[model samples]
Target: MTNFSGEVAALAAACLWAVASIVYGKLGARIPPLQLNLIKGIIAIAFFVFTILVTGELFPSITILPMCLILLSGVIGISLGDTAFFTTINTLGPRRALLMQTLTSPISAILGLIFLQEKLNTLAGCGILLTILGVAWVVSERTTDIGHISTAEFRRGIVFGLLTAAAGAVGAVLSRSAIANTQISPLWAALLRLSAGILILLVWASFRQQSTFRLSSLRNSKVIAGTLFAAFCGTYLGIWLQQTAIKFTSVGIASTLLQTSPIFVIPFAIWMGEKVSIRAILGVVISIAGIALLFYL
Candidate 1:
């Protein structure tokens, strides 16, 4: 019974991420991706520090090997992957970007097999395939009002999206390996990775001369509230749960479960008064069935 805890946590993390997406979608329009990333990382890290202090868990001893792996995971996964993802969204639009992002599941599965030698049972594999298919189906349904985008931009966006997915897969695998090899708490592991990622992004932004630390938006009460709420739900709690999932389950299963964020977003869309298509509803149903298969079978 307790063994399923990780999967349940992963599913809950997906739901949190889904809700956070609404806030972030608006914020993304107002803030540069790098700046937003840095701000959220800082906020989440603050929360992590406060939690650690309150809990009084002796700071876990960190080993050089796990530290390096976790640092690399942050650099590749959060820094590079998230930058690419934001660029893809800007260039290709969210639907197209998300369609490519769906590749993360299989990429993680293959990497887990090759690197971690993690094999899924027959039912779990089927569930993963079905879940990915369902997500792709829902995400592919785009609105008819897309503005014009150049061919070169489209190509560039696709490339960035693919890189983002690949980076995410590799990052998950590295984090899984780190956690498997170390005694670090998931909260601490998440903090380390996020700190590394934000530092890398800061350095890269400075090197590229694209650094713009905009604090003007924080003056807006609404923006401040939204940013804080989103950071708490998406970055702080979300990454903690993600680390927890990877610690307890196979990387392949954890990645698959996390990718179900879109399914959770369906209910959010309905709550926001967005028209839900029948196809989207059917896709959600299929995805739910797939999730059940992963657990019950």
Candidate 2:
């Protein structure tokens, strides 16, 4: 078997997630983000369990400290960060929301330094910046009139976006802290984090007097198919690749590569019959250049 680098894994995860996002964009019109998150999470967990059983992999005995850290990472990253991102998308629209998403790379870099004492060299740091710049440029091409939103509402959306970025960064940093130098399998780590996130969402739903067990959407065959595909691409395989990337690379590099999802989104968008603009094409070129620099320069 050829040994693939962490960079390859991260890039693949980004591509899968980009496709998942395109699918979810159509479904988001009908389903609430929280409920969708829980549903997909449950489905993904089922697949994860099946993989574990088929592989005959025994669960590792993890200590409380690492377990707690990993669980917290999921709660912060998936539970809170994803929810906040959904809210931002609703408030600010996907374009602005995607612009805000670029913040995660730098925030992860900073958090990685503070928590893991990980430092990037000059070229790597430049690559991160160039990647972010490319993604931001591609995503900020919307002209939606936000005049209807009050000043306070606009500010609230900005705050939510910032929180989403910070939570995601902190969560990944925590995962690094918990699993660094450990014998934990990336698949198992992903399972634990996903379970933690789903548990947290269930608890929050209960507290809100909402039912997390609603299955009306499952009745529709198309919806079922879309959900399963999203779960497989976005949560199941996407997360496993994310864990593998984190295990083999610095969090900064992993995060910068992962944020290239926007670049991948461009090709998918064109496939979906959306018109591709010159600026978006330029952004893709810039992002590819940055990735090349990160790996080769």
Top-scoring candidate (lDDT): 2
Steric clashes per prediction: 0, 0
Candidate 2 residue-wise lDDT, 1-297, digit = tens: 755578798999988877787777666666777888888889999999999999998988789899999999999999898778777766665444544666676666666677679776788678667856875676555433345676787778778888887888788878888887788889999999999999999888888865655577668888889989988998999999999998988654676677777677766666766676788678766755565455444
Model 2: runs farther than 4 Å from truth?
A: 89-99, 112-140, 144-159, 209-214, 250-252, 281-297
Give the local distance difference test score of model 1: 0.76
Which lDDT tens digits does candidate 1 get at residues 225-260? 998998999899999999998888765467667767
Worst 10 residues of 2 by lDDT: 138-147
Q: CA lDDT of each candidate?
A: 0.76, 0.77
